[model samples]
Target: MPQIPPPQQQVTHVNPQTLEELPAPVMQQIQPITPGQVRSARSAMEDMSAAAKTSPLTPIPRISSQTVSLSAGASIPQVRVFPNQATTVTFSDATGHPWVLGAPPYNSSPCATGGELCVGYIPGSAVFTIQPTNAYASGNITVLLKGLATPVIINVKGAEPSVKSKTVDVDYRLDLRIPKRSPDTPVYTATPEKKISLYDKQLQSVLDGIPPEDAQRLKLKNAPGSTKVWQIGDELYVRSNMQLQDEFEKTLSAIDGTHVYVLPATPVLTFSVNGQARDVEVELN
Candidate 1:
């Protein structure tokens, strides 16, 4: 009866100093994203991550090495280095062996002050990284390795690189063969132990299309042969499809049709073609 007596108008008191409870704010009408939209956003994020991971290098690293020989002597080879950049020199011959980089035999001007070039080497390996701070920096580095009568001397020089300057100068991964010594040649030097197996484990890297650091990849030009030649030291070796003569000893014949044979750096090789001996002249392309 009291409630029915009056539908009283509600009165609210407002206070400026004291806080008052207010009705909860209505949550924004949040539009929930559907599974497809969520998937699309996830896919976009994944694509971005993939792209970032597989981005191409600004300047692709290239192998531009040539073949050269190493002999026992005081002969020093020159390596070209870039200013403010590092160039690596690998003794492809002693890739897995231990070698010591002795104090550089000699250094000049800026190099003497240790400002022109900074030199370092990988542990227990004959790999050197030369960093040049001056554009015209130059110096000599001496290295001693087992099986050598004399130490290896490298001349590091600063150079300006061209588009085609990434050759052996930049890396110096050349075919370093000890100039063939005759029986009469009297040289007191330690030599690598004679290998008993024809299938040298060192060749596994070469068979996989990545030349072993010791293998000297021969650059061919206009050679008339399906065989590719790699010179490791003074010995000539090949991975070829040619049916070699019975006399051609092979270390491996992969199921992939690659037959590896080694020759004594000869100019001609005997191949069995059509069941006939075809004397193919081994020429470089």
Candidate 2:
């Protein structure tokens, strides 16, 4: 009985390679991922990543996409003010809204030098006054409006209260008059030629009578090509093409007591407006 002990139970072992070759179980269905879900998941992941990177003590930088610019308008009219005199400047916004005075800060060059130019603004009114110290205190007063690219320029001129006065003597003997030509003088005839020759001789005589000093004072020599002597009514006009210097009037006044005739000429003052040279007529009193 011992020798015939029960047959041992048979045992079998499968190789790992054989189990790996076996087919996987088939799944019945699966949920399809939509594009919206993918996007949401990706956004959530990005937000989480950003939150992790940022600290509570750190400040996030902000960026702006729009640009701002100042308003541009027509050039303001040139302001002319006599020294020690005051004038107001009023301006409106691009939308026609008047600017509040003193709201936009203003600055002036050579500021508050006691005798220098002074600029003051009146609150609640869109006006600013500019004043100089005296007639002799003359210079450019530039008023800059904050946030404005262009400045309001005021030309301060020294207008003296007193003007030199002198008597001007005229010689009626040198009066240029057009003689009445005889109607009997026929055109294209010897009579007309003789009349023209006589007129030329008379003109030469009148010219010769003008003294050399008088000619020099009148600036007749080296005068421009456009210079002309015109006789209008009882007055004589000597027009010179070039601008006369300031001393020209003084010279004429010095020659007042003489036989030479003097005709009043318009006086011009040359100045700069925003770096551009300009001429303005000045009345002499």
- Candidate that would win on lDDT: 1
**Residue-wise C-alpha lDDT for candidate 2, range 1-285, written one tens digit per residue:** 467778889888888777653333322123256679989999999999999765323212211110112235533223334443455555433211243433633444344655565667666654566555543455665544434444555445433332343221111111111122222223342122222222233233323333222232222333333333433233333333233322221111000111112244544433333455445443332
Q: Per-residue lDDT tens digits of candidate 1, residues 178-258? A: 233323323542222232122354454454456677776675443335667788776777766665563443344332344
Q: State the weakest 10-residue window (summed lDDT) of model 2.
A: 251-260
lDDT of each: 0.52, 0.37
TM-score of 2: 0.25
Model 1: lDDT of residue 257: 42
In candidate 2, position 263 carries an lDDT of: 40
Q: Point out where model 1 deviates above 4 Å.
A: 1-75, 92-112, 147-149, 160-169, 172-285
| Residue 206 C-alpha lDDT in model 1 | 50
Model 2, CA-based lDDT: 0.37
